[model samples]
Each structure stands twice: as structure tokens, then as C-alpha cells.
Target: VFFFLYIYIYILRTIMANLHELPGAQADSVPSAAKTLVWGPGLEANIVLPARFFYIQAVDSSGRNLTASPGEKTFEVKIVSPVEEFTRIWIQVLDRQDGSFLVRYRMYATYTDLYIHILLKNKHVANSPFILNGPVYHEGCDCPQSSGSVWETHMHCPQSFPQIDRDLALYASVDPERNAQEIPQRFGQRQSLCHYTVKSNKVYVKTFGEHVGFRIFMDSILLSLTRKVQLPDMEFFVNLGDWPLEKRKPTEKIHPIFSWCGSNNTRDIVMPTYDLTESVLETMGRVSLDMMSVQANTGPPWPEKNATAFWRGRDSRQERLELVKLSRAHPNMIDAAFTNFFFFKHDESLYGPLVKHVSFFDFFKYKYQINIDGTVAAYRLPYLLAGDSVVLKQDSSYYEHFYNELRPWEHYIPIRADLGDLLEKIQWARDHDEEVKKIALTGQQFARNHLMGDRVFCYYYKLFQEYAKRQVTEPNIREGMELVEQPSDDLFPCSCHRTRVGDTK
Candidate 1:
């Protein structure tokens, strides 16, 4: 009888231990709504973006953190106006599958105070119904204005402010003999160039080439920006190509031209690309400036992602081809491949079997992302830096407006143009795991702070403001120019919406 009792006790203990090790163990550990924790920047009421975010962590009855998601429907978040109970706001709860949840909500134009309720399994979280001051803006659909006083000045723009003045100075003096007003008329008709004028905050365009889409997209951004700030009347020529217009070496003299990107050798005034600010995601619709922060916040934590370096793109440059060879030589360290092979089609067998296109978010799965220049500057650099993974960018002269602010080791790991130092850098990343993770996080924070839609608009406003200061004569709408109307909210229903309160006139 004594032996049998001992056996029974041992068997019961084993069963309990096995149950604790099972996948459903979290189910047994019921989340205590009262003990759950909630915090993050999204909780702040005065944030400039229309979207607000906060984090929630599940805890048990004993206040211990839960290791996994409790359930899909476990956490519930609701944002409601305190004064008007009927007021509705859009709210989303993203489960990180690690006992934590990211809650995002859209801010609407309302005078009353707002309250955010966080609940787990129908019970209130530790700080449920957190109160926040309503947004001060009058329009519901418009981008929220910064409450801080420094937003309009160059101080509110990126660190590239000095570069803006220098680029404008390149065109500060046109050909001494030519009239200032005639400069656009003489050079605007060139291929891949367009003349743009802002009269009373409206964008007017005259296309000289087939790249009308670029002008339309840029005008859309300008229109969105003008709604928030009143830009001085200005006219400028825009180069709509991968190469800067000044670099093209037309027989005519170099003129001040705005470009999406520029090189160290080029004198083009670089501006933000619509592709960087508002690229469309397959799952998520048009990703606007406001949604950029939210998208950047997505993806797994650093430790949970793959440790190998990842690269995927077309065969746009020889450096990219060499990267694939290096990856093949060191498969364990890197995973590089071409998704399309046009430039080197003759060597198809050498790098054949093009891989399928990977989703942008999936790129975050790797510990390090390889950013190689395609034509000029890889437009994907901004989006890559926005992710949680560290970017191993190839050194290139080509740069965007904000590249001046990005420090090499501080923001990203710089690789050689030929990718010769890439292996060494990857090994270094492996050796200093914590340091690389910090760099990744710091880069992400930099992007979130500077590359957002609001900041892009601010950069444009500052650039145009500086350009307006140097105008020799008043800008007038030229013949053949057409008005580029602002895009409607219906086009970007996911990021933009019309509130019941009314539109800002």
C-alpha cells in the first residue's frame, strides 16, 4: 500500500508538469484584466499623426506575464468621446502573439474629451477607460496639426535643412543674360522635365514628357501639404527621372530643378518621392504618411526574427549580382536572390530561376536587410530603415532629401559599393548582437520621427519656402499648364476618412 501511494503521487506530479509544458498552458493561466499593463507613445494625446497607438501586456492573476496570446478575441479596445457617447471611432488591436497587443485608433474632430477602454475577456484592464483631450483641429479628415509652436519653421524639418539651402543656391544665379521668368519656358520643354507653379496654394503643372504620372503624384502631395500650411506662390522645374536633370548635360546651362533623388556629383534639389511616402501594400491599401508609423511598428521583435542577411530585387546593378554570388558562397550567412533578371538575361542560367516577390513586411523577418542601389538611390532605403531590422546599405553617392541626416554606424551599417565588406559586416553583426539590435531600433526610430508623411510635407514646405525667398520675379501660371486637383478621400479610404463633423474649408 505504501509503494502504490508513492507511485500514484509521482504519476500525478508528472501529469501536472506535462500539462504546464503543453501549448495550451496559457489557457490555464487566465489573464487577470486588473493586472494587465498598458503604455506607449500612442497614449499621448498631443501626437501629430491622425492615428494614435498604445501597447497592452497580458498578466495572470498573480501579476506574472503571460507568454503567449490568450485568444484572438481576448483583448478588446474602444475609443469613445466622453461628451457624446454615440460618437464612434475606428480602433484596431494587433496581437503580437507574445502576450502583448498594439492598439491603434483614428482621431476625429470632436470638442469633448475622449476615453480609451482596454478590456481582456470582457473584464477591464488595469487602467481601462484612459482619458485624453480631444484633438484641436476643426477638420476630421485632414492631417492633425502639430500642437507645438516650432512646426512651421525649418527647425521642424529634418536635419537636411542646410543641404536644401545649398541645392537652391546652385540655381540662385541663372545664366546672367537670360530672364528669370523665361528660364522655365526655355528648359521646361526638355524630355523628362516638368514646370510646376504654386499659386495661392494650388499646384499647376505643365508636362514636357510622358512622365505625367510623376507630376500628378507630386502635385497630389503638394495639394495635401497646402491644406495644412499656406505655401508662398512659387514656380520650379521638376526632373521626372532616375537621373537628375542637371546631370543630363543639355547644351543649355544648368537650371534649378527639383528631383526625387540626387548624387554627390549632381546639383539637383532633391525632394521626397511619393513612392517612399505613399507606397501601396498588398494587404494594406495605400500606405499614407500617417499610416507609415503604424506600419513601421508592425513585424516581430528582433530576437524572434531570422539572423541571416536578406536581399531581394531585380538585376539592376553589378553590385547586386555580386551579392547573389556571395550569398551562394556563404548560404548560411546571407540569403540574396534576384526576383527579376532583365539586365543579365544572357547569364540566366548563372542566376536563373528568379524567386517570387516577397512582401515588404516579410523583409523584417531577417536580422539584417541589404539595401543596394538600383538605378540611382534605392528608393526602398527609407522603407527598409523603417523596419525593425538593421539595414546593411551599400555605399553610393545617390541620396534622397533625408540621407544627409542618417549617420553610418548610428543609423545603419555601411557596406562597400562592390559588396566586398558585406561578409565582414554580417559577421560583425553576428558577433555584436545587442549592438546591432540597438542600431536597428535607432534607425527605426529615426525613420518614424523624420520620414513620416507630416515630415515629408514639412520638408517640402521648407524647401519651397527657401526657393520662394530666392525667386527673382513673381511666378505666373504658364500656357499649357493644367491644375492638378487634390486627390479625394475616397481613394485612400483606409488611411483617410471624412468625419461627420465636416471638412475644413
Candidate 2:
């Protein structure tokens, strides 16, 4: 019996040795968890944003690269939060079919360390349980305060600013002979531009425009942003008009003037409009009673809401007039009307008997909300999306800063520039009740996630950070630019003040 056992062991050893000698043999190229490598920006523990990613390359036990896929199912990746041990964060592993995998994950919770477990064939890989130190973000998803140095180095949010970055580059690439200070002076429109300067995290503004109300709100937002985070010293022009100031020309140098909205031909750096009433007021450390009322009034649920699309705004565009006419024709499907009319005052009879202004929150009483551009991209779209109703937006060339991130069917239902498809789309929405409701919920969630007060400030902070990098010359306050002081605590009703008072106790 001992002699037979010895013979069997000898035969097994000889077969294994022969297999190792053969080229590309399965027995010789088995995947080793220890040899496999994982590395990328996503592996960084200081990541504050949701989207994080890393790459995994499979290697053999002999430390040789595998040329083909070993099957994605063979690898398992998980990101587990210590606070929520039972709940595992969902991770996506995309097989490259080339012995590599791309693993993606999103951090949903705040102030919780995460453990990343990477396993190959249920065996622990090299650096298997990676502990990621979470950040402590402020209320409303503000910048993480736990690591100031990390925030300074990574001075950007997860959102992409393609157009803004492009325009910044264009402005930065000015003629060497032309002075940077002269660029703002040459393009500054007295009726639209507001020159602003930041010094030691304090914001000061000088209005070149007639829109004092708009300028005040814009500067207030800047001041509020500085209070939340330390901004670099910089000075730039902001256009408070519906139209962008910079028109790109091959021969002429383009001045990088910031604006609330932009189109295909414009190169203005777009920022969030000051017209977002709730966000603007909250940023300024103030909240009006009307805003409070709107917050409390969430409107009815999907089933209880009126089964018609609703829109009430000033007639500023031809498409808006057409919407009113369509609503009059198909009153059952749409309830659109002009609250005020200046563009077509002569044709009052055609689209008249101006409807009284409806509270912004009341628009959510209907299942669908219509968002037609007024002059430029309608600033109300963000506020409209914050409601509990789906938005049927008209197609247009104009766009805000966050427009690129929004998907048509996923976040909103798109309607043509003409009202020809309005009725049909409304009917389609009615037929697919559950789908439209989901769309409404998604749009609302987007606004809650990206357009909140803190996120808005974060966007402003990031925009200026990119702008600062592109400036050929240092930003300094110029002649006639007045200092806009921060308002006193008693002047506005602030939620932060209450927190301070409670802390003192």
C-alpha cells in the first residue's frame, strides 16, 4: 500500500512539471489574488464626490500578465460603510475582455469610513480591505471641512464644466500685446456687466449695469460663498443680462465675461442665475416668508394633482405665445397662459385677458409643468424641477451651467420649439402615468442633489477656481470698483445665526 501511494505521488508531480513546461498551459497561468493590481484616482480615501473608479489587472501566480479575460464573475468588488454594515454599496465592474476590469462606486453617506473588499475567486486580493477615510461635509452638501488641504488641492466638484472651461481657456489665450486689465474694460457693458473682486475671502462689487436688483443678488451670493469657503483673490466681470457679451471671432480677441446664460455663438462663462429665488435668498443668509411658504407647500402627490400641463409666465418669446394659443385650443390637456404680456401687447385680443400671477409653488399642483424659454433659457426651470411634477421643456439653443448634466427623457420630457407636438406629448405623458411620475421624481431628486444651496455655492467656488488658473495676470480691484461690505446679522433672518445662538447656550 505504501509503495502504491508513493508511485501515485510521483506520477502527479511528473504531470505537474510537464504542464508547467508547456506554453500557455492552464495549470501554469492560474490567476493569483496577491499578484493582481488595483490603482486609480478612485482608490483615494479623500474623495468627496459620489463617482469614484479604479482599474484591476489580473496576473498569473508566476507574475505574468494574463492577455485575455478570466471572466468578470471571477472577481468581486464591494465598498462597505462601517456605519451601515448590513448595507453594501453597489459597485459596477466592467470587463475590458483584456484581463482587466474597471470598478466604479459612489459614496452616498457622509462622515463614514468605507472598506473596499476586492476578492478573486473568493480569496483576498492584494490590499483587499482598503479603508477610505470619509469627509465631513457641511449641511446642504457643502465642501468637506474635515480636510481643508484636500479641498484646496481638489478644488472641484464631480460635475463637469465643459463650456465654462472652454471659455476660460479662450479668454486666457488673449493677445500678448493686449493688457488683461483692458479686456474687462473694453467689453464691460455699463447696462449689463458688474465688476467683482475678492480679497482675503471677502467679496466686493462695482456695478457697471443698471440692473441693481440683479447685481445685489449676484454679489450677495458671492459674499455668502466666501463665508462658506476661502476663495482666491480674483477680479472678473459678470454680465447680468439675458444675452452673453463675448462673441467669438477669429481675428478679434474674446473677452471672458461671465453671464447667467449662453448659446452656441457665445463664449461667456455661465454661472447659476441669481433668479433662483430660494437658492439666492438662502445663500445670502436670509429666507423670506414667501419662500418658507413655498417650502411648506409641496403641492399634491402625482395621483391627486390635476392631470393637465400648466405654465404661467410673461410672454417673452414667440414659442411662449404659441404655447398659450395651444393651451387655449386644448384646455383639457394644457393650462398655459401669460401672466403678463409686453412682447405682443398690440395683439392682446389674440393672447389676452392676462392671467394673474400664480404662486411658483402652485404650478406643481398639476402633474406636468411647461418650461419654455423666456428671452434666453428660462431661469425658472431649476425651481420648476424642484417641485413634485414632471417638466415638459421646449427645445432651444440657450442653456445654463448645469444644462449639460441633465438628460432629456431621464430628467425631463422634451417638446419641440413649435407647439405642434405639445398636445401629443401631453397625451403620451397621461398614458404613461407611472413613467412620467418617475421622471418627475428624478428631476426633483436632481435639483435636490445638485442645485441645492450648498451645491450652488460649490459650483461658484469651482468656477472661480478654474477662472483663477487661466488668468494671465493677477486679479486686482480696479478704479471705480466699490467695496460691498457683508450685511450685519440683524439685517437678515439667518438659520446659521440660530445655530450660533444655540451653541453659545
Candidate 3:
């Protein structure tokens, strides 16, 4: 038995070494025509694509000696997406070392380039008027987003088919602060930082992924604004801050919007700590607007652009400013990518005894652009698949909606989310109040497990730590690893990451 064990160990090492020896053989499961990688950087970066084999060939652009590993290592590249030009990357052959003839790309981190294709001819929209490209409009927005929407986005005139106009201006804004002085938000109305009406009938906002804390931060600010305003409006305010729930054993500050209702503490959170009051709302509103303007270079009499995006350290905190017109450009596309957003839509349920609002949340990776495709078919800088309950678009508007201002994670969750009286309809529960509690609990648990950072961080940390420690010399390891010191820069005192190779699998 001992002799066999030794032979098996030797064979495993030999296979690993020989795998690198065969240059033409691609690793198992990497793709040939590289699609977007889920584990790269930014929003979709957190997702993992299936392993495939492909070829890696790099050219030195900066005249710096190319650094790479013979086997597997993560490498960074300035992916010129529009032109498909990758500069300053070291190349290697990714082939099957399994002794099989079939070879593809695998191992290490490679750039996942996402492209948007808009084949719209000017004649279509010019000839006919349509409010938004078509979701069976007038039929009702049944998607997850529409489920949470407060007002209508468009109205269909029976006389004019296909012609749709915004039912009400759910979003509004005032420039220079003076315009806001005159316009009074209707009594019992909440406004976005941009001054847009926070409620829309055609839109049902479910989650602002990555905009606020993945664990539930920034939510209280939005709901608190209605309180700080004038008399009638203030009386209808919703208190998002929950104090009683934070007193649990672990003592976690629960965000307003959580993806998990299945968890206990994540159930319907009520109570206003009053810590995040109206002033905080105003501060958040102003700060977010500033971030947006700066990101887009929206100084008057100048073209708006992307922010000066650069990581404090490991080259990840990207801040760019560009115009929206160019955001959805195809293949080698360039959009004013200031921040990233994730959107979703779901059906509305009237089981109100406890579940007040069906919830969603963002994962803080504020770097991407959103191009609304359909109710569920938009293009993002990175990539994400469609999910049930919500059709989310990833873009600057989406990003700022929930993540602008403080950190990439600051956001608005359940505070004033328009539930449309969904909670007031729980009729058949064994216990009236208990049924409502069950519903709210369902949503909270989902956020805790799927959207919350502590939830994600714990799982990812455990898995990554194990893998990173297991790796001897692989580069571009994600944030946490025992062997690596956090990557840092003098600019942002808080921004840091682990310096490991980029993943290609």
C-alpha cells in the first residue's frame, strides 16, 4: 500500500509537469472564442464560467519584459474591448494535458470581454413612437422590476397603437439646487438624489445590486428623506433603520433590502433607529449627484466623460467617465461607464400578513455600463445572465440609483420601496400576523444568503482562502488569502486587494 501511494504521488506530479510540457495541448474546458469571464473584475467578475481550453498569445506593448508562469497564473491586460486589442500581456498555450487530442483553454484568469450589439436602424423609432421598446406595453409590466414599481412609466392611447408616452415622470431632477426650491414634491412623496420621482408605475425596482452594501447599508438614507421634508410629506415617511433586530446574538446591522427571506434575522425588519434621518438623506442625495457629475465630467459647457478610474492598488478600482450614447456600442464598445448596476423584476404577491416587500440587493462592484435591451435583455460591461423575479440592467444610472455617493456599496433598499399594498392582502394564513411575518422572513433570508456581503464574504472567503493557500505561486488571487498582504495605495486609505494572478478558467 505504501509503495502504491508513492507511485500515485509521483504520477500526479509528473502529470502536472507534463501538462505544461505539451505546449499545443489546451487545458480542459477553456473556450476558443473567449466569451465574458464571470470571475474577472467588476459586476460579472464574481460569477464563474465553466472551465474550457483556449490559446493565450500575448504581445508586449509597453516594452516591459513579459512576466508569466509556465503552468497556470492570473495575468492582467488592458483589454481594448472595442478593438479587441490586448496590450501588455504574457501569452501561453492552453491545451489539453489529459493525454486527449481535444484541446481548449483553461486555468488562470483571462479577460472576459462583453460586447453589445444594437442593430436598430434610425427609421424604426423615427417612423413610429414607442415609449420603451415593447414589453407588451399596456398589458402591464409583470416583471420583477414592475412588481416593485410605484407608478407607471408609459400610457397607451387606444387611438394610437404602439405610440406610448411616460404615464408620469417618475424621475425628475433640479439643477443648481435653486430649481428644487420652487418645486414641491407632492405630499407623501420620496425623491431620488437626482430629484427624479422615486416612484414609477411602469417600473418596479427590485434590487440595486452592488450600489449599496452587499450586506445592507445605505438603504435607510433613501426612506428617511420623506421624513425630513415639509409637513404633509414628512408625516407619510417610512423609517428604514431597524434597531431591535441588530440586538441579536451576532448583532448585525440588517440592510433594508435583503435577497434572503429564508433566514431568521433577515425577516421583515421594522423600526426606525432614527440614526439615518432626513439630514443623512439629503447628504446622500447631494453626495451621489456629485459623484455622478464627477464621474461623467458633467461640469457645465463641457462634454461629460467617465471618472478618473484606477485602483488604489491591485488595479481594480476603475473609475471612468464617458457619454451614455457610446455605452451600448457593439464589439469594441465605449460607453460612459461611471458605475455598474444590476436590476431585476418579479411578480407581486399579495400575501401581506408578514412579507411586506419582495426584496433584492446589489453586489458592490461599481464598474460597468448598462444598456436596457428589453424588460430583461440589456447589456452590461461585464456579463450576467437573466434571473427570475427581476430583469436588471447594469449601467451608471443603475449604479447611481443604489451605489453612488459614499462607497460602491451604499444603496437604497426596502425603506420606501413601493409595495403597492401587497402586504395588506394576507387572508388565508393560520395566523394573520404570523403569515405576514413568514413572507417578510422569506425575503430577508434570501438576501442574507444570496445578496448580503457577510453572507457572500463568509462563503467566498472560506473557499478562496483555502484555494489561495493551496496555490504555491499563482498570481492575482482575490481579496483574502493567508499568504498575501492586502494590496494598497496611498490615495484611498480604505481601498485594498490581494495581489494574485488573474483567472482564465
Candidate 4:
């Protein structure tokens, strides 16, 4: 037995030595085309319930194992909807031994296309999209038995739909058409903008995949209309977001409308929707409302909180790095750090010593909160506004759905993008304590009065009601296409328990 074990161990060591000598073994030797991305087992088009670990490996063109190269040249993964690039999640890569990396995403939400972008020195070496589908299984249902029914199913889970916040009904306004020449009128009226007809007459919304933002907008609109909107009854297909025509191979012929565009500059010609994060209605699940209550309950009032302006988030862009630099210079007056520094290249001496993360409640401990632009407009703006701390916002071109309504100085102080005047702004806020407190109260009032969940639904209902009329003809919600429901698990499957990689949610 000992002799046999010795021989087996010897063979394994020999294999490892030979693998290191392969052409693709070293970073310098491997040609750009020679590198390949591969998925681990059970990562099929229709994924099973109780998701398994999603793994992706970096290999040589010849299929030999190779460790993932980090730093300047590395792998970046995201799962985004083709039509509405608005819905996206950045997937974090976990390094394994040899040349493979595990994609640490729990398959809780159903998404299509694994968007992979491999860059070397900021140049794209390879970009590919692979399909990743969700299942039709119920929480208590045996998923394996009905696994084959995933593609044929649509909208079985009612809980996945966004519910109407009846308390916010007061925010609903008169139809947009009624006030085409002026701002619409608002009153406390429980009116259904659109009504559901007989099942055959109902319009079916076919989502290419699950996008939280898109889903919220669509679901709210549908729920307001009682799910009456549907595809047109005529021949052909329509497109929403950027559903690729070449890649779409539906089982049936249908009309597709090019509706709902976001994220990228490619604006939708019909129903233009901005980032939903601006409203508390759509992002209730992503942002903690409990934090707001906690802030109001236990934290000190504006005058008693920490005087330093605080900010913490991923190092997604150069602006965030600049914020960190300022914090380092005035560590006592300002607090900042990279929520996760592993993804970006940074000077350790400059950022490492000060790197740290704070809890959501921590914002209430400080009298001022810093807001800056991330990949898009900062998603944390609404959350920050709820903290009752004076907000020091940087100038940004990116706007959310309701950004136009927020006035600088009245609600929050606006700083230059270069952060040249952050210190001056901070000093001014401290000197004018009464004025700062008023601004903080105004920002908090805006969030409480206008950005609540139901108000968000009202926006969707109005937008869709107007958009629905613009269709060449009244859209008929007849049944004939495939659609999928969003997942409603309290916690989305994630690689890390505390944080989701590259995502605010």
C-alpha cells in the first residue's frame, strides 16, 4: 500500500512541474488569443435552484490551466441585461490555485449573458457574452422535477412584483396629458391609471432577463395598470434596451418595441427612464430604511454629531481616489477610504494606512456627508439625504430621475469636482451651524416627502401611461411570448456575506 501511495504522489508532482513549463504558463509567454475563459460545472443556460458555486477559469487557448493575472492586466465580469444596460452587477473574481478563478456570485437572481471584458494596459483584449438563465421553481417546490419548465414559464411568483405603497397614494398626480403645458396637479386620490381587462386582452410584458431597476419600473407600471400592458397584436417583434437582433432566437415570432434605455448614453427614443436609485420606492430592498429610523432615534442632532465630512465607497473612478487623498491630508476633519481596494491599482502608502469601512449608521454620527459620482450618478444620494447630516455634493453631469428638483445651497452644499474647495465648504458649514442644520432638514424632508417608495411607483405609472399612448397602435397584451419573474429572496446569493462586489446593493 505504501509503495502504491508513493508512486501516486510522484505522478502528481511530475504533472505540476510539466504544467508550469507549458507555453501559456507564464504571463509574458501567453499570447492574447491563447487565453480563454471557461465556466465550471452546472453553469447551464437554465440554472437549478439552490444555486451552486459559479466558477470561471482562465486558461490557454489549448485548454491548459493558468492562474488569473491580476493588477493592470486582469479579468472583469458583469451580468447585465442586453436591452436595458441599466440593470447590471459587477461580479468579483476569486483566485484559485494554478490558472483558474471562481466567480463568487450566488445565482439568486436570474440574469442572461455573462459579460466578460479582459483588458491589458487599458486595452480590450477580449469581450464575450454568455447566456445565464433563471429557473421557474417555487421556494417550496421541487426545482429538479420542474427544471425543464423554466423556459416555458412566466410570472408565477406574485411576490416578485413590486407592491403598491398605499400610503404614498397622495403623491399620485393627474394624468400627464392633462397638464401637458404645465406641471401636473397632485392630490390624495386613489385612481388606477390603467385597468386590467380579461386575461386574453391583457398585454404580457416580456423581459429579456431580470434587472432590478427595469423590473421595478415595469412592475410598478404594470401593477398600476393592473398588468394590462402587452405586446402588440400585429406581426414582427419589438426591442427594449439593446436586445441584440442577431443573438435573439425566440421560439415564436413576435413584435418587439425598442423601449426603456438607460446607463449608456444610448437614450431610448420612446420611454426614456433614468436611474431608479434617486427614489426610495424602488431601492427599498437595496438600501436599508431601518438605518433612517435608527438615525432619527439614537444619533445626536446636527450640532452634536462629528464635525468631519465622511465618505466611503469603492474606488470605481479617479474622483473617489481624489476624495481619499483629501481625507488623508485632513484625517481628523474628513473621513474616507476605498470600501474594497483589491480591484484597483493604488499607492499603498497614500491609501493603505487610512483604508477602512464604516457602518450606515456612522453617517448620522457626523454632521456632514460627502457625495460624489461613481460609475454613474452616485446611488447613495437618497440614502445620504435621509441621514439628517448636511450633504457636501460634488458637481456631476450625471443626473438621476429627480435630480432636477434638488437645489444646491437650499438642500445641500455643492463642491467643485476637483474638490479644490472641500475644505472651504466644510469650514463654512461649521461657521454657519444654523444654516447647515436647515439644509440638512430640507434634504431629509425631500427624501421623506418626495422620494418614498410609493412616489416612485407614481412616477412609473405616469411615465408608462404617457409612453403607452405613443405606441403606433394600442399595444395588445395577448399571450404568445416567453417571460421570466424576478427572484424575491430576502438575501441575494453572494460570495461575501457582508458586501456584494462592485455593487451598491
Q: Could you give candidate 4's per-residue lDDT for residues 1-505 as a string of tens digits? A: 9999999999998987787466545542343433555544224443222222244445554655453333212555555555444543424454432244445333334343444344433444343444444332212121222121231132121121121222112223323222221111111022111111112213344333233234455444333232212221221122222321212223332122223322222221222233332222222234344222332332465557999998888877787888888887899779888767654555645566544577776767889899997765676777678666888998875545556679999888999988899999999988999999899889877875555433443444444333343344333343433333333344433222222222353
**Candidate that beats the other on lDDT, 1 or 2, i.e. the better one:** 1
As for model 3, its CA RMSD to the true structure in angstroms is 27.1
Report lDDT per candidate: 0.70, 0.69, 0.21, 0.48
Off by over 4 Å in 3: 1-242, 245-449, 452-505
Candidate 1 ranges beyond 4 A from true positions:
1-76, 81-89, 94-103, 106-162, 169-190, 248-254, 280-284, 287-304, 487-505
Each model's total of backbone clashes: 1, 0, 102, 21
lDDT of 2 by residue, 106-188 (tens): 43334356678999878888888877675422223333233323454554455545656665656654331243356556755
Ranked by TM-score from best down, the candidates are: 1, 2, 4, 3
RMSD of 2: 15.1
Worst 10 residues of 1 by lDDT: 493-502
TM-score of model 1 (CA atoms): 0.74
Instruction: Put the candidates in lDDT order, highest first.
Output: 1, 2, 4, 3
Measured on C-alpha atoms, candidate 4 has an lDDT of 0.48
Write down the TM-score for model 4.
0.46
RMSD of 4: 21.3
How close is every model to the real structure, measured as TM-score?
0.74, 0.64, 0.18, 0.46
User: How do the residues 1-505 of candidate 3 rate in per-residue lDDT, one tens digit apiece?
Assistant: 9999999999999887777335443232222212212211111222211112122322122222222222222222221223336422222222112111111111122332422111112212111121111111110111221211121111110221110111001112112122223222321133211111122111011221123232122233222221111111000112222211122232332212211111233222222112212222222232221111121111211112121111110111122111222232321322122232222111111111121221111211212112232221111211111110111122321211112121211111121112121112211221343333333233322322232211222222222222223222223212221121122223323211222112222
